[model samples]
Each structure stands twice: as C-alpha cells, then as structure tokens.
Target: MKNLINYTVVLLLLVFSGCSEDLESVKYDDINPSIFPSSEADVQAIVASAYYPLRGSYGNGIHSTSENGLMFILDATTEILQGPYGVQQEASLHSYKASSTSFTRFYDVFYNKISNMTLSIDRIEKSNVNEQIKKKAIAEVRCARGLLAYELFDLYGPIVVAPLEVLKNPLDEQPLARLSNAEMVSFIENDLKAAAAELKSPAETPYGRFSNGLARMVLIRLYLHEKRWAEVEEQATAIMDMNYYGLEENYAGLWDITAPVSSKEVIWAVPADYAGTSENQWQLMVLPNNFPGRGGYGTIQSSWKFYDSFESTDIRKMALIAEFTGTDGVTYNRANPANYMQLGPIPLKIHPDAARTTALTTVDMIIYRYADVLLSRAEALVNKTGTPTQAAIDLVNIVRRRAKISEIELVNYATLAKFNEMILLERSHEYWCENGQYRSDLIRHGKFTEHAIDLNGAASQSEPYKALFPFSLAKISEGKGKFIQNQGYN
Candidate 1:
C-alpha cells in the first residue's frame, strides 16, 4: 500500500481535507475543545502549524519553504538577482519588472497565510487549552500575523480591503486596494507589542514557539525601519538585558546546522520533518555538474561581485561557497576556460543531506537571530551619533570576533558611514542566504535603487512608488468593485 501522505498531504493540511470532505464542512469544522488541551502538546501542534507556511513551496504564498526562497529572491531585489548568484536568470521576473507574476504570486500567498494564522488563533483559543499555552499560541499567532503584514507592507503597502479580500482577491481578477506605508507600520508595531506581552520567555517554550524576546527583536527592526531610533534602542536593549540569548563564543557555531539548539541563535524558522518529498533541505539551489542521478536544481547561485566583496581572509567568504569536484573527476573551480556561466564558488551553506546523502535533510531555515537584535540596537545608536559609539563598536566587534576576522576588519569600524557600511557588509555576509533579508538590508541602508540598477547592468528609472507593489486582482474581484489596484500597476 503506497503511503498517500506526501506533498498532497502537506497541501491538504494547509488548504483542505484528508479525504473527500465537503468544502464548507472543512472550513467551518472547528477543533474539538475536549480533544485539545491548553497543554504544551496542543500548543506544540499549533506552533508547528504556524511554521508550516515557511517550509513549503507556495512561493511565499502561506509560510512554507518555497515562498521563503522566493521571498529572498524578491528581497535581494535586482542586486542578488543579477550578480550571477541567486535567481539571476535574465528572464526572471524578479530581475526586471516590479509587478511580475512572482510579485502577484507573493501577494496572494501572503494573504492566504494570514488567513490560515487567523484560523489557527480562533480555533485554538476557543478550545479547552491551558491558560499559558493559549497565551503562547495567541502570541505566536500574532507574531506570524505581523510577519505577513510586514512582508506585504515591505512589498505592497498596507491592508485596505475587508475580510472578503482574504477570499476573492488572490489573482488578476478585479479591483485592488492598499493603505499607506505608515498605516502598515503602525499595525505591525502594535500587533508585535501585543505578542510580546502575551508571550513567555524562551525557557518556557519547550518546542521553540517564539517568546517576548523574539517579539522585541522584531519590534526593534520595525522601529528601526520607521527611524524611531530611540525606541529601537530601548526595545533592543531591553531584550539584550534579558541575557537569555547572547553571542556564542564562536560565530561559526551560529551557522552550525548540527549544533544543539542551545548553540543556535535562531528566533524563528520553519520545521521540516522527514514526512514528505518537498519538506527537506534547500539543495535545489546549490550543487553543480549532475552527479549520479543527483538532483541539483541549481536555481540559485552567488554572484562574482559578492564573492569578490568578501576579503580573501574572511571565513564568511569560505562559508558561503564551495568548489565542487564533480563525480566526473574534473573539479569545477570555474577553471574550465569554456563555460560562460560559471557555477563555481557558489553557496554550499546547505548540502542536500548529510545523514542520508540520498535524502533531503529537513533543516530549519533561520529567519531571525540574536545577533540581529544586537545589530538593530547598534544601528539605532549609530544613526543618532553619526558614528558608532564605543559601546556600539564593541557590540559589532563581539560579532566579528566570533567570525575570526580580527581587529583588522572589525576594528576598522568607526565613522558613521563606515559603521553603516560595515553593518551592511555584515548583514550581507552574516544573514544573506538564510534570513533572506538582503533586499531589506539594501533598502533600509538606502541602496535599493543604486544597487538594483547596478545588478541589472542598466540605469532604468523606477518610481518611488514602485517600492511597494500593487494589491492582487483576486482581492478586487472578491470585493466585486470596492477595492482599488495600486497606482503604477494599472
């Protein structure tokens, strides 16, 4: 008997039912209050469900892995897209137009995931769940909800439509509408604060549900985006004060997939068990020169420019890429004087699977880390000072010391512009692939357009409004007329 629980099962879990169930019955059917306790076990299951969206291939649609990689592609903007690294295909929609199908797909996916989270929160809350467990579940739900809003706010603008927008406005159907950027930020920040108050400490979450510290980390990020330097500093400092999570003695350990959870600094991620064909490592992006029926999708590669940017001595440069000696006996160092699109020295941060070379490893993708919190605090401080204060410099140096880069590279961090440059460099090196925050790093650092034009190898002009994408047509069609499409797209 073939096990039917595969990608189809994962799909059913996210969207529909296990068998031939009626659609209305499935949506309205609530979790049995008597069955689910507010115990750690029940909360564990709900937390697992929230993370499901980040691990799947819905193109950043709900919260799964595929959408996340796609999110990274979009976040990198044209810079990562063009550098012969990442999803750099010249014809790749993300590389050129701001309103490509990739954008549309992302728009739809985000809204759907938001709805899924809403369902999870509503059903779980009404259950006979434990008080603390319920609080944690709701907190995690809010964090997940804020994450969707932030991503959409970063890409589109704000929420405009009513509840119906979640149903009908997913495609190129009808009207589109969005709120101002400020409105989106305000919503995200308020929600994050709510999440923080409700969440417990990391020690309380045996299953890695997010905590108050994680909420604060995101709050710091949001405040930084809004240039609320004082608040960024305050929230970040408070989180750092908790002293629950701090820099490891070795920065390399931070990237160690095999390390115990204690060695890890991750704030949130998608969990993939050995359950299905799709829920595994992101090996599809790396590996080169087809080896023994090996599936190296090779969809994403690092660029020459990024490789060049890393100082030859930096450990990060080595950590990000690898030269492969193919099973064919010839080593590919881009030494083949023939192949124009060189695949050498590309990212190998993740291999297909170490435990089972034939199997795809179910590794969690890191989204937020403790280092990000410290950096956010440093950023707030430096922005106000126009130069990194000694405290800020020390915070950064603490990060670099673990990378083994030494005072030569890190001690050079001084002046404000130089500090900003160093921060961006660290972000690119530290969080690039895993966090998919490269594009946000560029934009917040004021490099979105300049770097985008450079990556495309063209000086094409883009409107300031193009920064936020338009709402999906599916949203408007559901409204039947009230919703309005974003300005540039129409």
Candidate 2:
C-alpha cells in the first residue's frame, strides 16, 4: 500500500532495497551500490536527492530557515539587513576572517552535493531507463548542480568540482584544485545550456521544479556578473519571449500565506509547508520577542538608511515595519527603540502568519521570479547599448507600476553609469531579502566595500580584495598542497 509518487519516500525505498540484512556479508572495499534508474520512477527519486541542496532546511540547503541561508548572509553583509549579534555585525561591518565559521561552511556542504549529482547523472545515463527519462533526469540534476555551482562561485570565486570518472572511484584519495575563473564559468555555462535544452518550459514545468526559464535566468545572472552584456541581453530576452511570466498584480501578495505555488511571476520557488518539508522562518528572525500577537527572536533588522531611501508612497515598504506596539503595550520606533528594536526597523519581508503556528510558515521561499528578469534585462539593455534606452526604461516601469511607485524617466539615466546605479537601487528594493544578490550587485558596481565603509565607518574593515570571501584555513589544510586560498586571507 506504499505510494511511490512522493520522491522522498522513494529515496528511502531505494536505500533499503540496496541494504543487506547481514552486515558482515557487505564488502568494505566495494563502492556503494548504485540501485537507481532501472525505472522512470527511480530516476525521479535519484534527481530528488539532487534537489535537496536547494531546500529550505538548516545547513543542508541554500534557502535555509536560519542564519545559514545564503540570502540571509548575503543581505546581512549589504545595507539591506543588520543586527547587533557577532556574526550579523561582523558580516555588516565586513570584519569577518578566513577563520569565520559562517563564511567557511558553504564550500564543503554544496560541493559534495555537486559530486553527488555527477554520480546520479552517470548512473541515470548508464541504466536502461527510457531515453526520454534519462534526458530529463540528467537535465534536472544538471540544473541543480549549475545553480549550486553558481552560488559557490559567487561566494568564493571558483571551487573544486570532481569529474564523474573521479567520482566513480570512492577509494581514491584525490585532492583537487579549484577551477580557474574562465574554467569555472564554462563549467556552469555548459551544464545550464544542456539543462535548458531538455527541461520543460515555464508553463509546462510543475510547481516547484526547475524550468528552462530558470536555467536561462541563472545564466543571465552569471553573464551579468561577468559583464558579458550581449549574452545577458540574449538570455534575458529569451525568457521574456517565453511569454509565460509577468509581474504579480500585488507586490506584497506574492509573499502572502495564501500565495499560490503556481504564480506566473515566480520562476522558481521553494514550496514550503508547516510539516517541515521546507521552511520559511524570516518572520522569526526580524519580529521582536515582545511583538504584539506573534513574537520572534529579535535577531536582525533593516537599516534606517535603507528605510529612508524608499519613496514615501512606495508600496514595497509596507512589508517593512518601522513602528509597532509590542505585547508590553509600548510602541517602538527608530527614534525611541526598545531593547529589541535598537538596530532599525523590522524587515518583515513576508506577511505575518496569523494562523496558530510555530516559527515556520507556509509562505513559499521565492528564489527567482519574473521581476528579476525584467530588471535584469533593463540593466543589460543599458549596459549593452552604453546608454539608457526607452526600451530599458519601460521594463523598469513595469516593475515600478506593480510597486505602485511612479515610473522613472529615461532621460534621467542618460549615461551607462547612471542607469546602472538606478538599476542597482531598484534591484535592492525589489529583491532585498528575497534572493540575496544585492551584495553581488554592489560588488559588480564596485560599490561593495565603499557601501560598507559609508554605512559602518572604520569598523567595516572593508578592503578591495575582500570582495570575494576568504577560504578557511581548515579548507586550505584539507586540500594539502593542491589548493590555493583566496587573496586577502591567510
């Protein structure tokens, strides 16, 4: 009576089917048994494990419920999010070192999953599963690997990615070197290209899975970072031509508890539930312990500088709580902050879950959405043309209209630099705590360290070379002589 429709349950079945009752009969010298891809159903289970790295758990996933979430760390380092805690302040002030545990944790956790995807793809291709099934499975896993690779590359330049043949040998003690920058870019580009060819289109793709549009969106991001203007334009335009995505009518409703997983605006979102399959604990991070109806840990807050930058009528700021009356019957605001509200305003990025509940909410963790595409294309157009164009201005207007803010004028952003500055601000306002790319946006514009110093003063310890974080001493030691640490770190 067991159902195989759920891939997580099938993963358990796959594991147990390969296990032996008598442990002594198993050979230690043998590689772990590959018991997958004999059927189309098995391929689904195999790829499901690849999706685990993208979940909203703690350390195991990128969109984690805690401070370990990549977006949380990325935004905390920028002007978007801040707090008085050691790690949060260290991130905000740019005082973290190679020894900092938070910056060091990502490489090992995600690189191993990339290796697992390599093994899964190898197995799926070798098995007798339908050719169509094998193609889709490999594409899904590759998209996952490509996305994970992009995240690690963004954080730490290049990373050690073992080949399938090397992954096939479990007994070998190989210490691999990180790929060169060009090599790393090509590696990610190839995976995404292959995946885009085989994955379903946005309308055809199921609720939480990767679509061809998502693959192209990640490619656009990579191209943007590398300043490959033409390529960025090409990819962003391709997603737009799909005609399947748009701006959600309500900017804040996208994060509402009743938000649909199938929203046309969302390209890729982590389908979260209260059952702990995937979690969203942002409310718990920003809401104060004495918040009226629902209290939280009072861990972090949005900066006043960021709050003041928004136009008074901007609807996006509705999600940010500048004042609130606590359960203690005392109102807290920026001028007279209580113990919990000292840093700034609460960045309640998502709506408060009114239903009786724990810290976790059912609101989906939106990783990539169409608003990003529209804004990214606008940046690309201006950068590609070397001047602001009306075409680009219209794209920005689409997102602005949804924000209920007035449209910006094309003439206002005449030069390339001026247009990019506006695009960066719009991107920050649109994606602040959602995707965490604001740090990269700042770094891309050469404003990351400057912004840190401008906000935090001398305590920032902001350095030019510190743009890419340092590789931990432990990671360097583990690589033996083959690994080279990032610059500006021991």
Candidate 3:
C-alpha cells in the first residue's frame, strides 16, 4: 500500500510536470479525458492525489511558505502557541496585512486543492469503473472537498464553492461569488451526509482513510460551529454508538511515532513518516533547538499561561515538557518568564519517540479522535438542554478520568455557562497542537477577541469583525472586485 501511494505520487508529478501553463491545461495532455483512469487502480491513484493537498501540496505552482504547512497558519494565530519573530509572530499579534505571504499561500493552496478534487471527481464519474466503486470513491472525494471548504470558511468566512462543472469550463469567465455563511454550511453538510452514508466504519477501512466515524465527526464539528445543538448531539451520539473508537489508555502514547495504528483514539489521520516520503513536518517545528541530532527550529512554544492551566496531577500535562535531560545527562528547566523568547516550555506532544531519533519519528498527524467526539457530545447535550445533565457530566467525567483529573459533580458547575467554560478549557488542554482547533474553539465560546486582547494586550475595544480573516489582496485582485474584503479589513 505504501509503495502504491509512493508510485501514485511519482506518476502524478510526472504527468503534471508535462502539462501546459495551468492545471486545467493538463487535461489536454496524454493523460487527457479520453486516456485517463481506465481501471479501478487508476481511479484510486487519482483519489490518492486528493490526499496530497491536505498536506498543503498544490502541485508545481502553489507553494506553502510555512514548513509545517496549513497547520502552522491555523495554530500560529491562536494564543496557546508562541513563535519566534516572523509570520507566526505576525499571526499571533493579529497584525496580518493584506500582503502577508502566509495568507496568500493558504488562500491559493486550499483553492488549488479544491480544484484538484473537483477534477478528480469529474474524471471518476466519467470513468468505466464499477458503479459501486465509483460512487464510493466520489463520496470520499466530496468529503475531502467538504473538509477543505470548511477550513476555508472557518478562516475567511464565505468562499466560492467551486464544483467540477465550474472548474472544467475554462472559457466561461464569469466572476465567482462567495456563498452566504448559512448557504456554505448547508453546502458542506450535504456533502458530509452523503459521505457518511457510503463510508465504511473506522474498523473496516485502512487506518488513514476517511470512515463513517470521520464523516460524522466532521458534521458534528460543523454543527457545533453553527451552534446547531441538536444536530451536534445527534451526530456525536451516532459516532459514539459505533463503539469502534475509544480513548487510548495512556494519554501520551497517542502521540508516539510507532503507535499510529495501535492508538484506538484516532478516528482519522494523515499517514506520515519521518522519511521524506509523506513526512510529518510538525516534528520539526515543536522540538527545542538544543536537542540532539535533528534539533528543531523551536519555531513554536507553549505559553506559560497555557502550561500553568493544567492541574499538577493531570497526566495530560505530559504533553508539555518543562525540563529535559540532555544527551550529556545534564538537566535543564524551561526558561524564565523574562527569557521565554530564548527558551520556553516545549510542546512535546509530537516530540521524538524514545526508540527513534528525533529525525526519524513517524508520528502520523491526527485529525479526529474519540476523545473529541465525547467532549463534543457533552457540550452539545448541555447546550441543547440549556443546562447540564447527568449524561453530560458522565461524558465529561469519562475523559477526565482518562486524564487522571478529578471528576466533576453536578454541584461543580452552577450554571450552563460554567459547564461550557469547563468544556472549552478541557478542549484547549487536550487539543493544543492538534491541528489548530483552539482558534475555532475560542470563537465558538464567544471569547476569541476577548482572549486575544487579554493574551496579547491588544486594544481593549472589541473588534468582532476581526474574527474572520481578510481575503488575501492577491485573491481579491484575482477576483477582479468579485471578492469583497472581509469587514474591518478594508
């Protein structure tokens, strides 16, 4: 399977490298509509091409400025992560300019991936493959497209939902218009619902591929973001009912390089390795600069406030490294508050495994996990009922017990607002570096701007419009005034 993935990548590169000026022009080459994807293997290879974009590769033309890809862009803007002076700093400080390279790279790369998926779906539908296989494959591709669209919507608000019909017609030069937020949510939900119906359960599919659980997970997230409490509860409950996934017995082991397949907690993840073939670039971002061979750039560090939030007995604190024993057996503690810039507590969640060198750890990038599903269910239940219930408390307790924290009782949270606060805090600790969820979680809780002001010491005046990132100046120019700059940016 690994060999097949590698082969498909090489085949795509060769085919794409021979194309004309644009990706659409590649359709006229030897790999044209008339000659492409004649068999199931060919269709599968095209689907594999869709997966590459999730890693932030958009073929020859689009390039990501951040080494860690889209994940860095998503995370760097949040309060939990502190970075050295550059794009990461710019993001954390909320000082994003229209010309920022990070914004342009993310905007271009994501849309490019969406276009690639649209083309792949078109080719798959037109192929001579078995009907069942074609339907399933298309469902998978649509789900991938929906996920990408959701990320774009989360960052930039409404965006053009480019389908195959729109992308394939090069001669039709009409301006693309952004969907309303409600319309966009409906669009993504429709795709995910179709996908969930066709996808195999997590236990039945290959470890890294999307599954019924993953599709539902995405829906649950979408509903949560929309504050559709009942739908979030329904989707989360459905995933829990599958009984195929659960929390890993050891919290820290979930991030171990060698335990990718063994960790039952992970619902969906990108297959990756330390080798150049499908590498996990995050390993190179979080490690401290002084570590042995393959020392990381130390681009991101955990804030002292984030570190201090964890209870002393909570085993999840293991994810943060406050001190380390050096190769020479010398002990080193985290830097003092005044010197945190030079040395701060490292996010050791994706650190090197004990059995492997820092440069060779193959920790897969996890997307959805069971613990998140449980928390989402709990939050949804509380919000739906307008108060906490026994079921909700029990669900929260389940995750808390696994983290070795004391379970909360009904009396602990006097109001629904208090319980919701607890859930948001738990999410922050559990999912700190796991794909930049903190930003959305903050927004969902209505505390994004407030928290940013407190954390970054920004202006006390609330600027709710800043919650949505501005469309890159380059993207707006490309749209020829069709794209409206997000409010407050202009």
Top candidate on lDDT is: 2
Q: How would you encode candidate 2's per-residue C-alpha lDDT over 273-386 as one tens digit per residue?
A: 665646788878878888887888988888888888888889988888999988888888987797676777889888788563888887878889999988988888888879
Provide the TM-score for each candidate, comma-separated. Answer: 0.79, 0.93, 0.88
In each prediction, how many residue pairs overlap at the backbone (N, C-alpha, C within less than 3 A)?
A: 29, 0, 0
lDDT of each: 0.57, 0.80, 0.70
* Candidate 1 lDDT over residue span 1-490, tens digit each: 0111110102223221111121111121345535553556555456555644544443333434332444445534534333243334532223334345555666665555665566566656777757777776788778867766676666665664224333323343433355567767877887689999988776564333467877887787778667788899999888877767776675554445452355446665444445442244455545444533464655555556677777667776775554555567655555551242263355656544544454455554556788888777778898976766877877777777766676434357667788898888777776656655666667677876666555445443444445555566666565566666666666
- Order of all candidates by lDDT, from best down to worst? 2, 3, 1
Extract clashing residue pairs from model 2: none
Q: lDDT score of model 1?
A: 0.57
Using TM-score as the yardstick, the better of models 2 and 3 is 2
Predicted structure 1, TM vs. truth: 0.79
Query: lDDT value for candidate 3?
Result: 0.70
